[model samples]
Target: MIRRNVLLLGLGAVLATTFPALALDRALTPEETQLIQQIGAHNSAIRTMAGRFLQVDSQGGRTEGTFFLERPNKVRFRYNPPSREEIISVGRGFYVINRKDQTQYAYPQDRIPLRNFLGDKIDLLTANIVDVTSSDAYMAVTISDDTPIGVVQVGLIFDKQTLDLAQWTLTEPSGAELTFSLYDIQKDVQIPKSYFYIDPTYKAVQPK
Candidate 1:
């Protein structure tokens, strides 16, 4: 369950969307390079974002949730009913709260795969991009980063026309995959600071 939660919030992003692997050392075309910059610019322009998300695990378990994000560090995911789970990052670290059992597991924000996506300025070129692909509808970039568990691959997809982030996928070292897609996303909206707040007094168990 702990590992699942780690991937849920740590490795979250889209279903089985696959693209042929591109050599990591290959040079990026000028168009692809420009697209990556545009995506980064689009991301940097957003101060806050709120949306509904659909999370699907490798086993096909589906979960719906509402998410809130504030630039540079904070984000929250409140899963729907039957899921007494919430993942919150209050800048410094991430806490996976299991409301049913009143248990909370904490991990350093920098230690999770989501750290790259939640940065103040998202520069795809600065990331360890392993793959890049584009079509009329979508542009995707896959980034590889190391975490405590192991190296994890994060695939980010954007709408080609708008360059807005559409979905993402995270592949764990153990071969488990988790996907997340956002909808009804409102950018640069006012999200209460309290939404990112995590209770300091709550006892948190650190993942081993």
Candidate 2:
């Protein structure tokens, strides 16, 4: 499962790298708007997702992991292969346990990027869409947001056939990128309430 997550993440990074040129002059066509609307509609009601993710850093290092996500705020990531680690987020805070170090780190939800993964209010179409383009294979939407950390670019890739989200990329202000791919997606799945609670045994640490 961890391998699956890493793979998904890698896929996302690949797609993000494929974004159209920043200086392109094409505007969002009617067809593109319709497709975007369709994609948004299909995902609007989705409340939970569980899958494997593979993440590759800019340096080409790779890690595989399994992840669980519940909308409006909750997620868990378990990395595997050589090292085992678990990071989970309740609605208001996040906790990470490093098995090797026997250390735990906890922080407010807003302090981490995980906050963005747990909400539906984030609308890509209405955001700062910098560019839009389409090909026979997929529709690409590029957007950016200004945050205290800096401007972050988000690229959304949608399958041309299904109009579903194939992947997304987040380009940090520092030029680092994190991507996510969705596969074996289960929508509206029932997740237990307890899944959002932090374990009491884990020590809590304040965010810097």
Candidate 3:
């Protein structure tokens, strides 16, 4: 099994009251509201996408990978050499597979923060949006939700001018954070269904 510290995908959690949904620290500005809506609509328009990603955890460990996404709940992340890990979600389930050991970990799609953004439609305005912040370069919307483990937060950051998703961050209840960024994205492209397939014979394991 993959080590928890290595992937830090301890995403299953229940809301622990540390991050309240819709209980914003402050109100959103008129412009901020408009931009948030536009961002939501822009992402909702993407039916399929392929891209390269860079993932960095709080400890500074970095991993580069290629990812494919099909709307309404399907995605595959294949890490580059030396890392035999792939995270695939086909409809209702998320699977983390270790190629080296043929070991797998499973999770329900709804229990993950990715569910909020991967659906056929994205509505930040109606989601458990806890905070919205912006800078000259990017606009960020932070969303919180309950999981079996504890409260988990995911932040989506979009390019300020283009309204395109640039990166996202996930924070575990234990305060470990992982930042994932996208590049060379090709939107509306066709990807094979086999890419999201889970090996039926892979050994199943629980999250560490």
Q: Which candidate gets the maximum TM-score versus the true structure?
A: 1
The digit string of per-residue lDDT tens for model 1 on 52-98 reads 99877778877888999888888889888878878888888788787
* Candidate 2 wrong stretches, greater than 4 Å: 1-11, 14-27, 93-117, 204-208
Q: Where is model 1 poorest over a 10-residue stretch in terms of lDDT?
A: 11-20
Rank order (by lDDT, best first): 3, 1, 2
RMSD of each: 2.7, 5.0, 4.2
User: Whole-model lDDT for model 3 versus the true structure?
Assistant: 0.76
Q: In candidate 2, what are the lDDT values of residues 32-109, reduced to their tens digit?
A: 778877766665566787777665555666676777777777777777757656777776656666556566666555
Task: Assess candidate 2 and give its TM-score to the true structure.
Answer: 0.70
| Residue ranges of candidate 1 with Cα displaced over 4 Å | 1-3, 6-23
Which residue ranges in model 3 land beyond 4 Å of their true spot?
1-22
| lDDT (C-alpha, whole model) for all candidates | 0.76, 0.60, 0.76
Per-model TM values vs. the true structure: 0.89, 0.70, 0.87
* Better model by TM-score: candidate 2 vs candidate 3: 3
